[model samples]
Target: MVNDDPRVSPEARTRVKDAIDALGYRPNIAARSLLLGRTRTIGLLTVGSTAYGPASLTLATERAVSNTGYGFRLANTVDVDIDSVENGLSLLLDQGVDAVIVNEPTSTFRHRRHGLAIPVLSLSEPLDLSDVELVVGSDEAGGVKEAVEHLLGLGHATVHHIAGPQEWPSSKRRREAWKAALEAAGRDVPDSIEGDWSAASGYEAGLEFAKRPEVTAVFAANDHMAIGLMRSLQRAGRRVPEDISIVGFDDVPEAAFLSRALTTVHQDLAVAAVRGVELLMEVLDGGREGGTIERVPTRLVVRETTQAPVASS
Candidate 1:
């Protein structure tokens, strides 16, 4: 019996049949890669923010590459470090990576537009790719809108926001969605506080909110801040749901076990990684033109952290 999977090329089938008869012949993919001026390796250039999301994405890329019998290289750069990004790009090029995957969360990404000689597949918010090969990312705007609407559906008067740094395109998208949701619902949009996407930042922001007797609910951009916000609210003598309701983005594993659990947006970071790799491969194989944009959707994960605001005691 012959397996007709298109993934198994004709030459590969002949080699496999011969190898089965010989009982042990192996193909040297590395040598073949060299003959074809390729390294059989993919490079992932990641930005060093969103620790948990990027980590999950990396794992997914690794798993996908392993299953496809390809090798991968990864490089991470700090936010706003041009030198670090250039250095990482140079290293990947020197390593002869077949293609590149850009996992930076920016709308104005330059690496794929002007930097590298190889094709680039970007994992970012849907933006104009212009000359880049393919782009993959979450529909963050929609996700944020859904999350905000969920909070409104729970009967909150108005949802206050603790946003991530403005430089990140994701933060901007979520902010836009938050505003849109509020506008559509005829709710007042308050002056939002900016956080560094850290638990400490959320805690500090929560302290400010605690001082406002009218603030009974908040929407943190990420789960880490939600945790901090919860802590600060607790310290301020406010019981979650009983006094103030809270919602967060990125349903991290710990969100469920928090003091009151947490309502959050669930972004499948692993899927983003796999999709990014696949798009890179397509470009490397010349299966598609550069400058394609892809967007994956996100969902809201409701738990114990959010509810209607209680009346003032």
Candidate 2:
């Protein structure tokens, strides 16, 4: 009644507004929710930095979510499996989140959700969840393909791969892309080495690579493994780019600053994050439904770690 009522004097309205401003009056969220029927909050469920890819995506999503004028609640798990994902979702629902964003969705995500209490968006790799919206991660496949192709272009006969854990969707994408790239070039897809996305696993793979004098090029799934591989190579007396060339995925903070400066796939974490939150918000507003995945782009960054293999005379 105080708003635009003919009988209400402008001076009185101004006085009340000034007084409220002076008092720094703020609305109670609970009371506001009762009126608007929306909590204006988001729930983030993620494994969160257990690996390079998920960690980067989570940090980016958090910043984007905050900038969008909505509060966010997060449920993080140490072990990313079906049960852990379900537990995080239920917790967010219990707390009355307006929507959920699955930041670290696993390859097994389709088997995890029985249903969602609110709109759900996933910062995902490829998935078969037809009813759920996916803010697909940047073109990991294309980026990895470039990494592989770069090695082939440098005249490597075949390239070895030290891949991340097979259960993760990103790991699978990178691995499959590597295989396809090799096959497309009519090069052999050498036996792949599996890493747990750890430096130790990469170091172990490095040991194996050092034993193969003919292995002239290699790609590791992420930077940690790549760094480890480099260390192992140095220790084994195999010079980088001279004896073997290496490529890594996920251009993390220190990629360019390392001793050998890693060549890697550059994905904009902030872009992925912003898109995920925006998609979740759109879903909360009933703006869009599922059956589609939006992909952000990715590219390859070349640095000191890679070069043309030493040509045999």
Report the Cα RMSD per candidate. Answer: 3.6, 3.5
- Model 1 lDDT, residue 163, Cα: 94
How do the residues 47-85 of candidate 1 rate in per-residue lDDT, one tens digit apiece?
766557666776776787666667878887775456777
Q: What is the lDDT, from 0 to 100, of the residue 247 in candidate 2?
A: 93
TM-score of each: 0.87, 0.88
Worst 10 residues of 1 by lDDT: 124-133
lDDT of each: 0.78, 0.81
Which pairs of residues collide in candidate 1?
A: 132-291, 133-290, 133-291
Q: After superposition, how far is residue 193 of candidate 1 from its true place, in Å?
A: 1.1
> Residue 96's C-alpha lDDT in candidate 1?
85
lDDT at 54, model 2 = 77
Candidate 2: list runs displaced more than 4 Å.
Answer: 1-27, 48-50, 109-114, 126-132
Clashing pairs in 2: none
Stretches > 4 Å off in candidate 1 = 1-23, 106-115, 126-132
